[model samples]
Target: MATKTWKIEKDLCRCCHGEGAFNNLAEPRTFLDKVEVYSDMLRECLDIDIPPVPGELCAITYTICNACIARLRDACNFKKQVQDCEQRFMTLYYKNAIQGLKPATKVKEEIEVSIEHAQSDTDADIVLKKEDEDDDDDNHFLGGDDDDGMSDDDLPIKPPKQSVSTMKTRPKPKPKPKAPPVVKKLKPPPKPKKAEPKPAKEKKGEEKEEFTLTVGADGKERFTCKACGKSFNLKPLFTQHYRHVHLKLRPKLRSCHLCNEKVLPWLRPFHMEECHGLPAPSCGACGRKFAFPGQVARHQKFFHMGESAHSCEPCDLKFKSRSEYNHHLIKHGDVKAYKCELCDKMYKWKRGLRMHMLVHNNIRRHVCHVCQEAFFQQSSLKYHQMKKHPETV
Candidate 1:
């Protein structure tokens, strides 16, 4: 079925109307949809484009011809005679200022920190090697190829043993009677296994959440916002309140006051160009003056060149310092990230999480020396022992 539609007005379709304003004979050809019919109407009349009315279908009935358009251009600014005259006499003089277009260029800033921490791992490696050597010595005598090359010819051979016939000759005279076979009475093969139905599995209980230790004192903590006089009851509340109130001031607040406008205090240290302004420390590596002397040296070492001194031997990744190297190791994804998915306990490894879960569940494994009572994690065990058996550390 074709979608139903109506025209704008009778006067708009004067060409199709004869007896009636909306002639049934002049009705638009039906299509599956109205979009195609509307498109045809738009192309039939070209006044730039057919204007549309809200909540109604459109019917194009007007068009601009090339001849009429040429007449309008003749009566307007675009005149061919005026253009020919200007071309023949060069009426408009060209200026040198109008430079042609060119490709654009951009400069990108890049700061890289090259850290090296591979050396600290050497001591542990040496200790592990020594431990392996000791274990090898105890388990197997791994002698050199020189000792292994010795053949049986290197050892003295022993003579063949003589038979002890004199003492047991009496028993050999008569062969002992053969013992009867202790045959097992035949039993029918077990009833062709009535497919031992698998025992239904019982799922373990769901894990619990970790115990969060709140650090507020006296069940209340006073927090004063630096920007305004807002005080919050809890630290978390204070943090949220601070962010809400002082978010705008954070960019303005990090400055140490001693340095003036020369120092932007943002990531980039802007220098105050005045000579009378206080002196700024220049970075040793890049010779860039920062607002602060210590900050300048740190930036020079860490951003300009090889700043990391410690690194992992296994993966040549570097760190700015020992602490940074330790933090970087977390990215390798091998060691324990220390997060207890079950109870929200953090550990360096899965094993640590397991141990921590046992603690939360109060799985006592260690025994006290004095009271003989067991406790969970070693720390608790030690604490119990100290309380009960003080001397048995």
Candidate 2:
């Protein structure tokens, strides 16, 4: 009997069992030497512990997708927040309990200190009043002999001073007389000046450029502009040149009635739905709405009308639209017409080249609604949703 070999699938998420771009948990370089380990976080948040397997059994990829990683982070943050809140609550509870059990002796001491301060303030005020009365009495006895034509030795002996409960009140000074107010006559307002007449503006007539059409020997008509002396073979080209170059007018644009914004004819549909909150154009046959008019027309012709205008002989495939048929033909011929400007990468279809160019830029337009993970391509976002969040799809 021949030995059989089995192929083990590795591109799967350990948490959600989905496949897409995944981050390796076993590799340290993939985590950028972060302190928090993926396995530890999973165990902490979801209580899902991964066993430590030896390097010999490393054939399986211990990886997690972007969506799963986002979920894990949210779970970890929630757990940390709950733990912190519990710790804070317990600390506050203990503090309040300790404060409630404080001794009543400290409260009694605080009341006694406040009463002493009030008593001290009253006593100090009474002492200051007595000192002021004594100083006034001594000054009154000494002031009388200064103008009495008597020396200090010839002065009569001072009598004993009687103690007064309060000091003598000082006399109030008289108020000065007020001056009379002066009045003056007011001047009349100045007269208004006469207005001057403005000069009349010159009116210039509009210059009309006449275009003459001439038939060539080969029966091809040519248009010649008289203003700039430019010639064009087509009538539309001549009209466009005359309007832009001679009249200085741009091409006519349609203005949105709701927003009053001018937009090109081709981009009007997109602007209406995106800006004005209008519904996309729907098909009358199936009542199915499409983002663009081209999609609605294709849907009506392919499904409703059962149109298959283009067919492939080699593959026996039929496509309703010519563009789709051309795209199908490129696979058979292996002809790559679209080339990347930044890097010389080639693609068979223009859309393939457009999606490939996103690798050169950092733009992630498609985003997951569940975990809010962004992707460069819409297909990648769809795949992530199908794997990680099947319920949302």
Candidate 3:
């Protein structure tokens, strides 16, 4: 059985800037010492990418303590709640205050004018009623002459004249002035002229030809460039060839700045985020950052704890994880299964054969940033760049 070993350098915690609170390895002297030990064991995940290479040690994984993890969680939760509240408030204000006052809903000026006119009409009616009551009281006081010689049957009768104050006439509506009719000038009819002949568009060489492709008996897709007329089986190779050689443009596939991985220019950020250890999940048991949570869980269960649920029948090797056990099962009859299609070459592992096939296809996927040199294998390019260009490294 092959045993994998890892060495973690003794460094101060990134959060507390001190070694774990536990002073003795045998036992904890105080409650704070135990808490410190727990803090050292528990770690929060970061958003970084870990290297795919096995046995590669990363130093940045175990910097944060568990105490800081709790604080960070509480802070993030509070921030999210505040943001949600603010968003709800803004939505309500827009619906009730801003959107309600839009011209499409109600006219502010017309409402104000109508309210003012209604107040004036009400005030005028009240003033006229008070004047009419005052005039009636005055007439009754002057006509009460019963003590002199006037009898009830000999009183002089007079016709009542229409008083302006007594009669309540409605205000006449002012007539709206007629607007002047718009005089639209008639445009003269366009003069008929002889039609000029349209020039024929010249066909471009690139657009004129169609891509010619053929399928082999092996059921592999093959493509031929229309511009250069070069035949290729692999789509990636053909695309790279068409872009650089035929189109006279640089290939869109960019090499990773840190590693020899090649990816599209647009996908560079995503590839770097997942491949490099920027902010990746770290294992609580061992300070190893992984690309995913499942990876860290597997590492904690298998490496640090050594708790295996399954064991191989033939080899008697125990595995805590399902993927590791399945991989071990494949090694029981690990014959040379992978074979090269172009040449009489066979490899025990599929990855080895896949790397070997790149040579036959003549696909140089890895490119060095310093010298702009390309290589068929990533390992070769990595070693070449490191050795040849030590200054860049």
Candidate 4:
């Protein structure tokens, strides 16, 4: 057997900073410690994308591909690289938020009034010219009849005063088009002097509030890490990050019931029932419950167990049960598997990555698909819905 040598940088792991990791040493004698250790290592170290929240501890994997990892540690500044990526992320996020703004486009009431006035003035000029021509013709026909009827100076001079209704109903004239004045070409502004590009250097770790990532023998990586003194395997993570997200692997559970042994959810169901006081699962489709663990086995044999009725048409995926089918389909679309090797920021799906992108890009476009809430990830969308509007589900 090739003995694997393990070294956790003493600077990396510490019991303090109030962080702990669970270990699934090759064979854990106690199930309680076994479950915690396995979950912690996977969540915290091997896949440090998502770290534990206030009351939680992240999962860490006890596997690392030695050759690939050694290659990684050798090639680049792991800490600086992940941190720089995060800062760039926040900057980009701010820019997106700036872009999502709507501009105002409106025609002013003053412009409307000016157009109406111009039309009316043109119409008045045409009417006045016609009236003056009629008067001139009358003067020509009644020439030199001053003494026979009345002196020309004394002749009745009646002014045609328009009535209130006539003035109000008068048709306005078409306004003349004025030539648009030539537009002055704007002068180009002076170009800004280009600043010299600064040489890349690792940031002083103390300057910002930092999230730490601790790497282990297993290929998986995690945060909230202390140097693991215990010698462990250096197996690289074969677990696909997208498919096996951390919390999903943990039982959909409340506080654990067993004291002596932590509930090993990953353990074969039959083994759980035999070894621990696990309640036999009743079929949701048919309310028929079972007594030992052998019931599902018998049902599979008798019922349409071999034939899969539950299936997704899009992916041509089928499952024995509906729940299995649903869970499988969730994996088909763009899923979030983003883990910040920087701050231990973990998103449930790609949108989570996008939202993280927004935090860097400063994009906040993730409005609520449901109510007053908006989120960066689908998991967040689901969480808000569950918490605020449970009935909506």
Candidate 5:
């Protein structure tokens, strides 16, 4: 495998302009050493993979400053406080800056201390080897077995001589003084301090209100409003309170068609339904009365409803359906199409033809069977039959 050497580019930090310690632009050897130490420490402790760059030497030229690093560190530390300082630092650095590099990997700091200890032991072993080499050199300097040796019996002995009087007399040895005995003064252990009582916390200005359901003696459920804590027997009152207070809506009134009484617009149909004795909606085409607007709609749909009512622009005559209107539009061939039932004397619409036919058939009356009610128009006879003899019909 090839050897790789890491290099950091001298880029001025954008945040601090190369003034802060985080600025990698500084070329000081001490600063670089410290950075390498910290980086290696973090890599080992946090399992952080250094961002790899291609080539034998890689230069880091990123744009994060010391202030941001410190902030990110505090943010991660406050949430993940650990006993180990190196591990805590690594966790902070890796979580914010390098989490994208490798996810869900953990590291430890204890192994770094062991590595330093091993390095020191290696250095100590080298010193011991050098000392042993020096000792071996000293032994080689002494006489060895290869050197010439005299016979052991032929060796001569030196005679002992008496001390000379001319030598300078040695001074008598002085009596040695002894050290004073140490007096250890023992002190009493400190007394434990009493814990002070904490102050009570202040209450908030606004209190949260709760709404609950309560059963009454009448075996009916009552609703309570969260705002006022008041109980309402009727659900409408509860709804009104919610709309009036919470929604802040004003009550709107509308006049009822049946009784000419002012009522809530939403309740007008119900009022018409309940007030049967009051004046009801009367059909203009058939002269029939209904109790409510819904009933009138049903009556119109079942009795007189058509595809589309068409009226002639020239004669003001209305046709019940689109087919009849189209048939009657041929009189003013340029403007409409109209057909006459009695004769070829085409008019703009059927009404003009009917008016002209009235001269021929003037007796327009229908007699009812049960009441013998005779009316000039068929609609009048129908009204009489439905109102006077409704059960017989």
Candidate 6:
């Protein structure tokens, strides 16, 4: 007996039946919901209604495609433009009709006669008023009495005016001259004090030896460090310990030719190319280029020399490249360096972390051309197309 496999069905657009991109109609506060609420707008503009599915109720998956939404927006905008033009035209027509009105025949003659008489009276009154003002001004200047017989002594007395030559103007005072600045001789700086010499202390013993070699009971040569009093079985280990701990010596660093920045000998080429825009080094054997000198050397060793330099001792597995060896070592170690900030999920590789981040964002960038189905990744899209539309492949 064969086991039955179950599959989930995808939601299709009600109008187009294509599932590339869509907006859920059942969701509230969404674009499709607003279109449903104002269904008459579509009818008045485009003369169309919402497409309905027989024997099925609109659910969360029931949606309208982007194409239909765009058409609806264009129709609504056109309808609004036509309405605005009609309103503007009617307003201008009424204003012109009021402004173009004609006066009554009986009022026209009376209005013209009244305007002419008013203009002639205003001109005569202006001339007489100017003559009267001139006569009053002349009488005032000649010291003539008023018609009321008021004497000049009883009127307000005015201050006497002075002639230009008769007026006394005070002269401005002159500014006092400034004195020259005084200069004093500065005293010479005092001499610096001489420091007293400190007495030298006596040495305890002749300088301590760095290391000493001895023969152990097991017949193995032992290397001992006199400074730290530590022993090592191997000479290489003893030398490395003395150099690192006692001497405090680090690896020799090289400066970049372009930037003058000091870096480790192994990292100098990479630093120069990445930061200073220099070309990467190429493999002399195969003429293949790489971002760093180390990669070129590794490539030469692995491909040209056919050597497997990296190996796992526990699993006894060997890999031709450093990257493959590192990847194989991940199974043995429980180290997770990459982590997702959204859900606090950890992954062994950066690619795994990036792929997991898509779940939090929920963005579908890859779409199947045959079925118009959308997916978050290209691999998923390929799988969907292969299963649903094999003929298209």
Q: Give me the candidate number with maximum TM-score.
A: 6
For each candidate, give its TM-score against the true structure.
Answer: 0.21, 0.22, 0.24, 0.19, 0.17, 0.24
Task: List the pairs of residues colliding in candidate 3.
Answer: 46-279, 46-280, 47-279, 47-280, 48-278, 48-279, 48-280, 49-276, 49-277
CA displacement after TM-score superposition, residue 20 of candidate 1 (Å): 99
Better of 4 and 5 by lDDT: 5
Cα distance off (Å), candidate 5, residue 84: 70
Question: Which 10 consecutive residues of model 4 have the lowest summed lDDT?
Answer: 10-19
lDDT tens string, model 5, 213-330?
5544333457787788888887677776777676667577865433558887445535745773323455668977643444555456546864234788888777656787777777
Error of 2 at 335 (Å): 1.4
**lDDT per residue as tens, model 2, 1-393:** 999974545566777767666776533222332334575577557867554344643335567778877777788889999999999889776445323343333222222121211224455568667777987998787744567677777868796564442324342343344344444444554454444544665332233336886654333457888887888998788877877776777667866655669987556656857995544567788788665555666687678877778989999888976899987888899778999988899888888886786677655667776787878777898999999999989
Regarding lDDT, does 1 or 5 come out ahead?
5
Model 5 CA lDDT for position 293: 42
lDDT of each: 0.47, 0.66, 0.57, 0.45, 0.52, 0.62
**Reference-based TM-score, model 1:** 0.21
lDDT of 4 by residue, 280-311 (tens): 44444565645422454445444645556787
What TM-score does candidate 3 reach?
0.24
Candidate 4 Cα errors over 4 Å, as ranges: 1-180, 183-226, 233-253, 256-278, 282-304, 308-393
Which lDDT tens digits does candidate 1 get at residues 304-337? 7657578687798766679878776776766656
Question: Residue 392's C-alpha lDDT in candidate 2?
Answer: 88
Candidate 1 wrong stretches, greater than 4 Å? 1-275, 284-287, 305-307, 341-393
Report backbone clashes per prediction: 16, 0, 9, 49, 7, 0
Per-candidate RMSD vs. true structure?
46.9, 31.1, 21.2, 30.2, 36.8, 35.8
lDDT of 4: 0.45
